[model samples]
Target: MKKERSFHVYAIITIICWSLAFVLSRLVMQELSSEALGFLRYLIASLVLICLIPLLKLRKVESKDLGLIVLTGATGFFLYMIAFNKGVKEVNAATSSVIVATVPMITALLSRFVYKEKITTKQWIATGVSFLGVMIITIVNKGFTISNGLNWLFLAAILLAAYNLLQKKLVQKYSAIQSTMMSIFAGTIMLAIFLPRTINEVQGISMQIIILVLIMGIFSSAIAYVSWTKAFEVAENVASVSNYMYVTPLLTTVLGLVIAKEFPEVSTIVGGIIILAGLILFNSDQLFSKKVRIKRIGNAELATAAQVIRESFATVANDFDLTLDNCPTNGAFTQAKHLKIDLDKGQQLFGVYLGKKMIGFFELVYHDGYQATLEKVAVVPSERGNQYGEFILDKARKIAAEDRIEQIDIGIIKENRRLKKWYQKNGYEIVCSKQFDHLPFEVLYLQLDLKDEVTNE
Candidate 1:
């Protein structure tokens, strides 16, 4: 369904809500113990979630996927929350958030080994720099020992990383909001086993603390997940969405300074810079090589093209809120679907090859009897900025002209400023904007109206 809410707003909401958890948990800690705090957080969240299930009309998980769902719930909530609460008891919220910032770098590396996802050299370098940033914050005021809650936070981080990966995978089949609700519910059950120890703490809680805990559960747990879940729907890669989380720590640190009055050490600031620098370098495409050969590829080439597209967009899965498998070229069911585009229907499947390797792939869809929609335009990470993107656009224009089509259109994320500007530079202008389902943002429909230009030829 099309959302009236902006995904970017939701993304920021999730971050701010989550960052507040680090501080809110601290407030609750004055009265409730760590385990009790964690339990109440989920319990309250579960209540709010239960109410939403009916309102949202969420789908129920299949019996077959029950086990995976439960495990993900455990990782996301039970283990992660308990450890996080315990760790936050020992450290300030800002420091805790900084340690948590290591999630993106860790998730990428873990995916490489576990899912066999390939990481580029630049990614590895970025990971190292980010890791160094994490180390500076964790080891500065206190040594690397468990005394300052580094061990507990470390454990919480590992579990959080696992939770995010599990959520990403599950969102492929399930709705993000529903799946998140289920995971929270599942984790609440696990935490229920320890309820007896903390059950007494609930009644004794002060009204101020009670109000804060409810806020955490309702906003951070229930609402923040809307963005988290919608991410997989919007982005082709998880990294694209998760990259925004880098700000969580920065925000938390600022909140800490202003609200909690916790002054950060110099090492903390330096580490934050290192982390930002690494992420910046990772996102930069320095390749000036635009020497791409555009051609129609055979079915034998689909798998290679698919892999290139997957690798090219793997970061989007991590950085963005969207799921990786949702891409037609990478999805389980659609990999073959694109390979079988009906040429007779005037649908052209094209590959952007650089020296025998298929670095980018796109489809010119001449369907619905209107414009040839240019779909799935992607350039491999290392080969971007080589004019492959423009090459695809030019090819689409040629095909549109040959087919006597009046328009060639492409849909791009409204938030992708650089790409949107690039498309404008190449003669495409936004004709319309509409909400796309599952995606958190609006898709701008841009077209090169070639009627007059083609007639001149």
Candidate 2:
């Protein structure tokens, strides 16, 4: 289904709800230990979801996929929660959140090796710069000190990274609700083995604390997830949807102002802005590239192009949330196109494959006068720090040379200053910056002068 205006409204509301969760969690923590709280939160979420299964009318799954699902549940859902909860016990809530915020960078790094996803040099730079912002918060505010005790937070961060990757994998096959429910329920079951320890902590809870915990369970765990899944469905890109998670901490800080009546320190606000800036760069096209490759259709390839543009897009309609309210597959195909261009150069499009699956794609226009413009290019969660993105850009450069194109222009959104600096390191120079008033974006044009460099070489 196409994302409507309603999805954006729901996403903002979900963020607000999630922001409040930190305040509630803070209060709940005074009464309950982290483990007890983690266990209980998932328990409520799972139980509620299970009760709704009949209404959801979910279908039975193949037995073969059960093991993968269980593994995902354990790593992504259960372990991540436990690690996060325990990490909070060792550090203040602010400190823990700062560390946890690195989840996206970690995921991008892991995705490269585990899933063989390609990332560009610009992406690694963005990831690094963005992570630097995270370090600023931790080192500047939290007092940079390490102890053997802090290992738990590291482990927790790793678990969180794994959790996100698992969610991505599972979301490919199952509806978000189905995947989330199974993982939550399975995770709840696995953690239930330790219920006795948590039971002992229940005696310490006051009525207020109990209410806070319930609210956290219902809103953050259950309701927020439903909204997140829906938001992801309608988002123009999955990464864009995931990027919204970076806002959680900002919301948390604002909520702190309301609930505790405590104004955030100047440093806190500064750090938050820096972090957001880095994330914008990290998430924007300066570090991430999306390409559509098509080819001239010979008689033999017309059927293949039909399948690529028409049928393949149809298959991912639900996954991509392009269903536009569950429109027919034919309706979905109507929105797709296969075009032929006339230019000084004759370029053909090739097949498009993501994670080894061929999907609908168009050709990269290679012409004498038309320059290829590159923009925000970030590594996915699992493919960071691997130099894969550089490799892709190198290939593009070679293609540019072959076609005798004048230059390649990449636009980095200004919100991501980190990526702009990173691009400088890779021989891309910023030529201009322009603001977009309607959207919260500013464009930074980085030009790679092939003619000048080629002559120098």
Candidate 3:
């Protein structure tokens, strides 16, 4: 709990620094071009990080990961800073912050494909709501047309998302400080291309502009990245830390009013509120308590289960290009008739419900007093990350134990490493793998000893 609280504090600090940047960058941009501002800001940030290397005892990144680190720096700093500065110059800090605040949702959406991370149904709705908010802002900002600045900002958001994924991967093998420092150094090198212009601008800058630029660079660019990376390292999940960004628009708005004397337009206000509403919904499960239940389903609900199974497996089918013509037995092509047949054969079907809605389904096919086959474990794509599959598996284990079944076995596609790791984490062991004539991919079989599970329980 203390560690979690610590990371939360760090994350909030990073957000505040970032929020301040949105306002301060606007002030600094009055005298500097976007390219010059980005170059100068991150040059200071890179120098600061360089100064901290020996003090922090940061490790050198391996040559093998150097390419990924450079890519991270390019996306996160070089590209993002240029685009962000351009957008902030064109719009109020509040509006710019709101648009950039979509980074968390964008990251989540991208992770669904890039990292095979599951997003819940509510999250999907939240994404749509947030984009609707962006649309409103875009239309209003340009009198029913999208502005080039907003487009740049959206592209920046995507680059930031890419950076987040790359940083996540780098931080696994490198310390947070090391990763942040290296990325900034690499980004600073790229930003150096604008050095001549930045130097020209700096030579004629007022002392006030100098102070503002320094703050933006040191606090926002350097400290904020380090703090955010530290939060990522300490937090249990990326969402926990990234969610703090939702606070950015509000903070930036307040800061904008106080520092820049800029009041948001009516559209900016309305659009920001809508965006925040969507963000709140995206994180509703964490914000509010949810009632989840698992129970045995009957023939009357088999049709619903079949529909859920088909929808759930359809994601896998789409991902792996499975079809009835190629893998006819794939669960995506399952029908109510097939489930009914399984029911008639004494296989027990179960459904996991969130409130009154069934979001996941699975089946247990008894083999003997000592064993059972756990098959067709499926969670609707949007409801997956909520741990509905784990809940169903837990219920299955309990049912198996009650039936005196000593072992439970299951099979999954060998290419599905994420699912395989999940099952393995839950105490399942790989027995073997086989390439069946009917299937296009190899199937890996896993078994869990219910005897040990019962004793542990």
Which candidate number would show the highest TM-score if scored against the true structure? 3
lDDT of 2 by residue, 1-457 (tens): 4434456766786777767755666677777877788889888888777777766635366587688788877886678777666665555444445556666777878988987767668668877776666556556645785533235666777876887787766643455677888888878888786699889989867888888888878888888877777775454344545656777777677677678554555554566566566666766762354532222334344345455555534433434454444434222343223223211234444343333433433344543474765422323323335343444354455456556665778765565666666666455777999875543445678877665222211
Root-mean-square deviation of every model:
14.9, 18.6, 11.1
**Model 3, span 105-130: residue lDDT tens:** 78878989997888889899998898
TM-score per prediction, in order, is 0.63, 0.60, 0.64
Per-residue alpha-carbon lDDT of candidate 1 for residues 195-275, written as tens digits (9 for 90 to 100): 997888887678999898888878877777766766544432334455677789789988777766778778768877787
Clashes of each: 23, 43, 1
Off by over 4 Å in 3: 1-4, 234-240, 289-457
- The alpha-carbon lDDT assigned to residue 57 of candidate 1 equals 42
Full candidate order by lDDT, most accurate first: 3, 1, 2
- Model 3: clashing residue pairs? 121-382
Model 3 lDDT, residue 413, Cα: 94
TM-score of model 3 relative to the true fold?
Answer: 0.64
What is the lDDT for 161 in model 1? Answer: 83
